[model samples]
Target: MSDNDSQKRAQFLAAYDEQLRTDAETPSAIKVIVQGPLRLVTFLNGRGFITYKNLGGADQAAIQRLVPEAMAYYQADAEIIRVEWKTRGHDHAPGMHEALIDNGFIRDEQESIMIGEASALAVDVPLPEGVTLRQVTEETDVRAMSAMQDEVFGDPVSDDMAEALLRRLAIDPGMELWVAEVEGRMVTAGRLELVPGTKFAGIWGGATREEWRGRGIYRALTAARARSALNHGKLLIHSDSTEFSRPILERSGLLKVSTTTPYYWKR
Candidate 1:
């Protein structure tokens, strides 16, 4: 990469870590506890999450000690059946991986952190014939969208996810849910969250049916969300994208700023 490109990536990563590593990322948390540099969050759906802007320059020993302490906090809460420690590849923590593993956390797949101007993704992308895109707000539509995403991601189709999404919409109606459908059947879907107090908006939960892949349906859905983000005055777009979606977003002008891996633990 050219020096100019490298510098731009650095700036985007810096902005992401600074603006997104706070309560902005956990707007739906029911409870948040601060333990040193760790933000231990509890959600209504029996999930615990851990993240931080940085490690406060802590060394290996400090990180090892902090890991179990954070775990014990969540363990005491029977309501939290599972927990995830979010790790950033660009972070300087020395022994975070070992610490998490030793504490019974299992590493999940790593996703690329993509960021760039929302306008770059707002360009027109033609959808296949009979496919249409629109924003969904009703409960039935939300449930169908969540079910399609769960099926696409290989998770069991359940009402838990739909319930959580409905609750989230109740809390922040500004969060936009977009979907691509063919003749009244949902084929692709995703979400747009306009982060308060920042210029960034996140595109998340992107999923397209296997048969719908490579048809430009996902790209068109993404463009619609990007246009909505731009309409809401959000200039920057960010997403932790899987390998399947990373190349598409890269082609849409977002840079791969870094990587994030989630470590999961269940009761």
Candidate 2:
């Protein structure tokens, strides 16, 4: 990358860490505990999440001590059947991976942290023949969209995610769910979340069916969401994208600001 490009990436990453790594991340959490720089968030469906804006320049010994202490905080809460410790590639913490593994946390695949202007992605894109995009608000449509997403991600189709989404929608009107359909069957799905008190909106849960791959349906769906975000007064867009979707966003003018990996622990 050129020096100018590197500087731009640095600026984007800095803005992301400053604006997004705090309460914007866990807007709907049932509870949040502050332990030093860490935000231990308890969400619905027995899920606990851990994240920090920065580690305060902690050394290996300090990180090692912090990991188990955070783990214990979740372990003592029997209701939290599972916990996810979110780690970013740009973080300065040393021995974080080993410390998490030592505490029975299993690392998951890493995803690119993509960020860019929402207007850059709001352009009109033609969809595949017979494919149409729309924002879904009804329960039945939401469940269908969630089920299709689970199937695409190779997980068992269940109501757990749909239920959680419904609960979230009840309180967060800023969260919008968009899906692409063909002949009344869902082929692509994702969400646009307008973060309150910030200039950022998140495009998350992007998934497309196997048969729908390589088509421009996903891009069109993203454009629809970006337009929605822009309409809602959000200027920037952010997403933790898998390899399948990262290239698409990069092509749409989003930058790979960093990487995020979630380490999981289940009781």
Alpha-carbon shift of residue 44 in model 1 (angstroms): 0.7
In model 2, the number of clashes is 0
Candidate 2 per-residue lDDT over residues 1-267, each given as its tens digit: 679768878888988988999999998899999998899999988999999999999999999999988988988988989999999998998999999999999999999999998999999999878888999989999999999999999999999999989988888999999999999999999999999988999999999999898988899999999999999999999999999999999999998989999999999
What are the RMSDs of all candidates, in order?
0.8, 0.9
How far residue 68's Cα lies from its native spot in candidate 1, in Å, is 0.6
- Runs in model 1 lying further than 4 Å from the true structure: none
Deviation (Å) of 11 in candidate 2: 1.7
For each candidate in turn, the TM-score is 0.98, 0.98
What local distance difference test score does each model get?
0.94, 0.93
Local error of candidate 1 at residue 201 (angstroms): 0.3
**What does candidate 2 score in Cα RMSD to the true structure?**
0.9
- Displacement of residue 238 (Cα, Å) in model 2 is 0.5
